[model samples]
Target: MDDWVDPGETLETASFERLYRGALELASSVERTRAATLVLLTGRLGLTLEEALHCNEGWVDWERAELQVPEKDPCACAGCWELARRRREHTDPIREVLYEECWSPSPDRAPRTVPFGWSRRISAALLATADRYLLDLLPGDARELLRAAGEAADGIEPDDLTPGLLAATTVDFLSDLGLEADGTAAVLGVGEARVEPYAAAGESDVTTRMARLAGVDGSADPESAFPVACGTEAFESEPFDVGAADADALAERATATDAPERVPRPTDLPASVDYDPADHAAAGGPNRRTDAGSWAEGPSAADGNENALRADGASAVTGADRGRAGLPDDPSTASGSQATAPDVTCARDVVTQPVVADFSTRAAADGLCGGREIPGRVILGQEELFVLWSEEKGAEDADAPHLLVPLEDVWDVRIDDVPGRLSASFPHAVTVGHRPSGRDELAVSIQLPPAQRRDMASALYRILLNVTPMTVVDPAREGGRVTDADPEEMVLYVRPHGVAFTDEAGDAARLAFDLSDVVDVERIERSFDGESRPAVQLRRVTDNRPVTTVVTAADDRLRRLVWRYVRREYHQTLATVRGIRLSDAEKMVMVALYSTDGTPDLGSLLDLTEQELSAALQSLAAKELVRSAEAATDLTGTGQLAVSDRLESVNH
Candidate 1:
């Protein structure tokens, strides 16, 4: 065979149009059926050589204006058998790991139905040439005819002529004429057709030929005609202007490369405000002495006659102590002054203040690390929850050691009201379950003040709602009437990762199911007390054992709700390909696979080469629409949904 020109390579629009018109005109030299086959193969119908060859008269539906491509039995060729053997070998290890049966022994192919309209040109061609076996119309001289056609148009030999090349050329021509895939399909009386990736640009001589033939202006705007080629040049040619003063400033800044000796002060800093002693006292400063007498009035006051010196602002106070207390120097006690001195408060004096909780108490001591009984205050920050604790009691120190837990690490939370008998001061108990980095699951319990319990719970709940992907459904709010069979009231939460059944209050999680483990969901009826109640049954596979859960409700709508949401989640999780744009070949393969039953031999059925089919399958797998090509070749739940949505659009 001669070296075949790659159909995916770029072709000039003018050349493509010339070759296409030449092929149609040269159809007269061949048999009637052979000529019709060539036209059909090169048109917007997107047919493969094998499919066009296999087509028969029975495929057409005149009344419905439709065409049906009947399914073919599995090919027993040596190539197919070798391909199957390689697949089985590759999937054997995977089957062992999953411990489940994967592939079916034999699969059946499903026929595809496409919309077709009756037009004068197409009707006449089909009526004159269509037969029981269309391939019979083509003789061994077909290659000679293709060579003659190519030479007449672009001086190319028969080696360059192929079904893919012809189809790609025709699709590109139609696209340049302002007809999209759907529009082209309508005009040609075929299913969906799309322009190939490499044929997107209409810059070549082929485009000029096509323009002349179609009566379109060939000298239209270059940017619109060739966006990929002219985009950067157009952008670079745009004018930009700068003012003289701005340019001078920019140049000055660029030239000043020398390092300054000292950093310049920011001009935007605010001026200092005068200090007020009364305001400082109200803000918990050292000046206002309470019933607790100041050390200046103690017995040491006389020894510090010494006290007289301190009163006169002559006492030696260390700068470190003032800094530790976050205090400013007293203006009244300046040097050479006789004003009364304010009492000084040291770090030790500040440490003696009482805290909100008594850390030494037995109840508070039980919540720390393995009963080590350290004293601490639990502080909930915006992103993390932490406990600040110190060995010394009665101290609220910011420098104390603490344990930080990011809110995301917390997976479960339990809140309960502490009985009065346990501890009257600490009335609310909150336990948080978390798994920290490289650590096993652990629980931390804390007692909250009576007044702060509601606020703390509300904040934690808000954080959980924002971070966790969950949809809470209240049975009562959704008009569900609970039956006696399920006496315990429960709430249903549908989540992307899983589902959970909680108590009616939505606080306690009673049961949970991961989405992956769920195999099926259906509606069933359960009898209790001589009455049948509608119920939804969830079937899951866990630990190689089947487990079933049936939730009963008085009304059938409740069952429907559960079934609908579960199915919807399954479809959504598997069908991530939805709403995503696919390539032309990928879309066609997806539709073909969806229209089939079981794991049919798509390569043979669609008449696709092994490489072409493999490429399409790999692309679909990357988008998560199917398993890898080496695995069972079938459309996943997501793939099916994607094809269904496409068909729905076509129908509309």
Candidate 2:
């Protein structure tokens, strides 16, 4: 029964609370390397992989072009620059430098370059490192928890912040890691200012207050306009005193419910017993008698004996009132005041009931709801509900409407627990719908900002998986081994996976290896199966033509055929446009345009760079058709060609 209860319930209801916290810290070292690589590729080489991969070596003929590629140079191609190997060299040490520099007060004294370019790369790397660190700090059952969180945070804007999310993530991380409660709480409180702004904006005062109760430091600088629609803390803190007292007084004030009168009136006080004024004078001195006579002179005072009783009772009542005035107001006092005045906003549930309750009850009655009887409401046509909820759930961990409800009420919930769903941020995608199909039910979805999602997932998944790329050389592979060896005759080359490298020497006919032949297995404490990309190979058959036969190593043709099918499905296009490794495509397009001209060809088109034209001409000459000559033409030849074209058009 205890295990069956929701963890949140246990956390809130139990006398003691325990949260799992992560020991790992978040950083962006891994991301920095990728960014750096992209920068170098685009900035230095002027190439975009999106377009350059379209031209293969054969497609880039260089006979008439000036770009040179020595046949014997193995390291002289654009695709074989060894970016991952280079990245490893650039990152590991630099990350340590950055970490130390950040910790140091004197940043200027830091031992490395901190340029804008460096910062971008570093930020990217830090983001990646932080994700892995977070995963290590989460629990094994973190998936369910994170999914619930994401669902809770659905529809939230990336910029919206809330303290509920911060506390939730903190508590969840601590609980997942099985950390010491005190230590977890302390850590949760640490950096509250930094985390709170990213998590607490746009939330209700109650929810924000609750977050503060949990030690969240920051407050919404500018409070939200629709605070009621905010998260639980505010909803939970809905005052039940004088404002809500109206509901109880509903029967007393109006002939509403059948309940008995609950509101107390001042007139309901007991009447004082009649007494003689002579008794006050006889018991006390002249001072007491004089005070009694003064009171007796008032209009409310009755005849002699009654006036004496009223004066004595008034003195007694005033003394009691003085004692009460000294005592602080408690719940009872608060209730007493409401009982007399019955202020609707004072905690009276007078006219309006909790909107959530109405929604829940209506939904349950219509089979549209299931959850604890929380007294709150979701206004119809309120678009900000999701944003408010996400702010509560923390940007990353928040899910959609379903997570806020009891898990039992929901038939099915879908979540993506994996990292990188939103680019290294574990922004889990969540959706809830009735049955397998239901038109009557409401379905909502959201893409959590990449950073927030990653943070949440890391907080949930306690297991950290490291991704380190390595370059390996295999002797038996066709594209030649990645070894410290001399250049040899090879038809194709293979580039390292997930890294961008440009050939240094710029050689055509350079041997490039396939994505296969080299394994990029993740070393996850040797506990998990490593993931790999689809493999491919390039080969030239006996027919004197290049045919890329994606064959199996075991000589199993049928299995190879099946693999081809799978690969085709995975890769989709076999036109070889996706895998080419080059710097610029405009050069190729320019050369192709020039190829249409005859005779000196007026040189190549103006748009092409020397590199693309050179590479292409080399490939064309290899095919033995296109030729080039240095036929320097004067201005007269250019003019004559322009005039000749115009005359030809007129004659037509």
Candidate 3:
């Protein structure tokens, strides 16, 4: 049983209540040194101060920045809300946590090394202050000393670790990286330091703060968060440079320095940003919105406004849902009424079941690897997707599978097929992932039966294909950056049509080629540490050129998936052409046309052919690979349109 006390349970006890009351007093010390006492006790008690203080407050949890307090639930007991440090991960097989599935399967094992990486824990301490009760405790029941102290447990909060040193370190770190220290300081808006750390701190914490300082933060929330803080000491020390604070001066300086406008003026909106029904129809698809509203808002408009100042609310709004798209999540809406007991009818009857698809049934995923929860199958719970294991060998053991990918967290997928598995899959696995801002994309593979692999590939492709476009720009710029730079010189971003790269700052240049144009992709290998680290290389339609671009973190799966998608039409065309029985001469003509720009030497094809030249011309044209320009045909737009659309039309 867990030793941590639940305030709701123990608060009624008079002795325990008195001890908790004392902890509260010591924890929030006006005399900073007393706060140190609370910190010390947290270590001794083996709980983070936040976890400790939360152990009290009716076991209230002031979760992260918005301070969400989840209502108590059946599983919100001391075991899951552990008071002890994590020597081993909690699991469903043992610890009854918040939800059966929320239980992590990984175990705490010492790192594999010649000498064990960790072991041997022992502790001793010298105390300066003691009470009569403390004197008795030294030689008294060992349980009392190790047993969680009620007074200490009821009131510990995480140390917002004085932000002074952290803040200075951040500024100095940026300066050392060749950034102008004063310019960076001015951008942060303090007199070199102090007075409210990263204003973004209210909405974010340490991880978010570091991302912003390094100019790499993305709009997506961090996987976890911890608080950051600072006090008023630097503000009290000195005051300087009051004039740079003037809004008009800042604006004037921005204009004089040729900085880009933070938002497009309504008058400056690109024509492409406006909706057009005709173009959508021509693409063989209907517009997603028929309300005559714009369908082409700038790519980042949907997700990039979280850090925007409240004063800039007008600019932050998107064309959809009247700017509601950019709003931060509201914590107040999360009070989902206390988790409650269910009536008998609330549970699904297990006696009878309806038919399920063969592919979706557990039997389909069940393979030589035992059970429904296999290494390749997705584990669903908490409305998310995760693969149970990364590798299958000995995966029956919970601790062996070190990787678990929450499926919905995946943003992009690229499959690379390996020889051996049917039609082309190595062990029939594909990797799916998301690219974070300018960072490399992360991919994890899930093995599948060949029958299921095709279905999974299509579903994953459609999922990533539909995500609204994203553009990555330098995060440190006061105003955002949008560019028209060439793909070779820009940071890569995904769009519905293809990936884009911007070579210049602001609205200078953007190079986005259609996905259809990508001809091939290859993996670039690196082995600096005797382990393979590879990047992706993409080639456009012209195969002779060196690979067009290399995307970091793009694994074998991405390389394969891109080529698979890009060559579907090419393969289809070849399949259709191969159906016809074309002689060597006719086949040679088409091959030459495909290879050299659009013109082919049918003269060589017709000059030494066993068949008549007229017959050869008719034969090639029948396959739609080539057509006769001199044939008797209507002088209508059809001829001109055909020439523009087809590869080439040669004269007889």
Candidate 4:
């Protein structure tokens, strides 16, 4: 509590996002902030949470051997001096801002500060790397998409721009890809000279592309090398929309699959044979023959009618009709003459293989879940869909999932609208939840631009259908992250019912939670295969002094099994004690106390009214998750009974 004041008190805490913006505003100078931020963000000189909160130009001298904090008072009791906490605050919001955007985690123990927002001063190289990461996350042939965009954009480097700019530029490039030199110039608002360079540079092959990625110079000849591995024709990244032609294509594919019948292609000739060239010539001379004989005997009345019919037929053969026939509207005007099919990949599979196949009817695992996927991965292997999502911290990392969930276990996927918006620009969110374990439920939110929601959802649906569990659960295996082991030894593997481990005797042991004594699950970092797999550490209610045993992350799944078991047990214990879901007010109060080092006076800190506080306390008391009245009743001055015996595990 030494010289700390909560910034939330003076500055409004209505929207937590503001806290991040405010930090950058108070960062003193933009350039200093950008540079120090990059260092802190990149985890080069790893600073702890305490250090990051108090960091300033004076605080962190990365070049110095010893990390130093000058003797001067860092907080002015309301002064501008950088301080850990002008008031007690939780670091989650701040951490969320930095890591999700620019900060890359380091394998080492030293903590680092991460900011959520950005300014243009951020180096171009860093922006490129970040954009690459985003593109990597998108499902599909990312390389092909990149190459196609580069070709369309002429010579602009794909990685030269930030993610936002890259996305916009890609849309333009793909749309203008087949345009003629003149059309491309018109679309790009540039001269034909610029279009030539883009077109000339467009044909780089895959080998040269890889060379470029490796920092090699000179473009690869398109004929010499192949385009990106996705087979260069390219898949447009835009979400799908259905059209009549697409519907017919789907039907054709279906018919072929069912009966392998050959389908006929439409004729190159006009559909209507009503046109008479002689009549057309007499009417408008459009049907005039090249022969000298035709000139000698001018078109007769019948010839005039034929000429008019030809004109009418030509009109019907262009525009919409041409599109339906998959032909150019005007053969001479169509650019490049290298046009491939309109990128129909998204729309092709969308309608037939929708997330929920036959939504008007029921199908097994047929429902679609569309939302912003959480950070965790869905490893879809041969036989299973192992779903994992988490913030990968203490308890969260432990309960993460790894093994297969039976196909039938996945059910109850429901989509609900989340009303309201933080700003005019931000779209209203929609939440999607699915029960992958039959018993356990997980949910995610989609907050994309309104126009892009359906497309994103379609992409997500395809991914969900394809995902598999990281590894099949096998008891004989050395690594099985979730262990429901026997009671005596250390838990090294997570079982369906308990955890397994090696004891002090160097013998295998197992332990199942009574669902009472376990306090919290903390992920302890350990190295494996030159990579670090976070191991789980348990905190118990029995003895605070003794250190607990670690449950290792075994197998291919990243700490999912251990994380899931620990968290599920923790929640089950609370549910047993509380008997129902905690209200928003109750959860907030618990979080507030937890954030403030488990102290009383939570209502004032959270800016909750007395009535709200009373109701929340009542719920906490009924659930037996907290002693609301105990702190108020305390005769000697001390913090309130902030959390219950079971709930205390969550706080840790």
Please tell me which model should have the higher TM-score, number 2 or number 4: 4
After superposition, the stretches of candidate 1 with alpha carbons farther than 4 Å from their true spots are 1-17, 20-33, 73-119, 131-144, 154-156, 177-652
In model 3, the worst 10-residue window by lDDT is 115-124
Q: How far is candidate 4 from the true structure (C-alpha RMSD, Å)?
A: 31.2
- Taking the tens digit of each residue's C-alpha lDDT, what string does model 1 give over 1-652? 1121344452455454455445555534334335434544444343444444434444443322234454432221122223333455553542232122211111221244433221223333443343223333232345455556566665555566776565555455455545445434432234452333323432222212222322222244533443221111212111111111121222232133122111111112113422121221111111110011112222221122111112112222222212222334534432221112211111222211111112211122223454332344454433455554543333555555444555556655544322211211222245555667646655555544222333344344333322121222222111123423333545444333455555443345666666544445677665544666666665554332345556654443334445544554454454344446687667767766656543547776665778888888888888766663444466654555566557664233
- Model 3: per-residue lDDT, tens digit, 1-652? 1232321222222332233233334322221122322322232122233222222111111110011112221222233323112333543322222222121111211111010000000000001111101111111221222232342444422121222222333333233233343333432223423322322212112222323332222332222221110111111111212212222232232233232111111122234334221221111111111011111122211223221212211212112111122333433321111112311121111111110111111111112233222323232211122333323211333332223333334555433222111111112244455433444555444443332343445444432222222222221112123323222323233333344443322122344454544444455563323555564444443221212544432344334444444344334333334334556555445444444434334455335554565565566566443544543211111112222233343221
Clashes of each: 9, 95, 13, 59
Q: Could you arrange the candidates by lDDT from highest to lowest? A: 1, 4, 3, 2
Task: Quote the RMSD, in angstroms, for model 1.
Answer: 34.6
**What TM-score do all the candidates reach, one by one?**
0.22, 0.15, 0.26, 0.20
For 351-454, candidate 2 gives per-residue lDDT tens digits of 12111111110011112223211112221110011111212111222222222222112232223221111111111223332321333533322222222222
lDDT agreement of model 3 with the native: 0.28
List candidate 4 segments past 4 Å from native. Answer: 1-509, 514-517, 526-533, 542-547, 556-558, 568-622, 625-652
Better of 1 and 2 by lDDT: 1
Which digits, one per residue and each the tens of the lDDT, describe model 4 over residues 273-388?
22221221111111111110110022221122111111111221222223422334545322111112212122112121111210110001112223222333222221223333
What clash pairs does model 1 have? 12-206, 13-206, 13-207, 14-205, 14-206, 14-207, 15-206, 304-307, 575-638
Pick the lDDT winner.
Answer: 1
Tell me which of candidates 2 and 4 scores higher on lDDT. 4
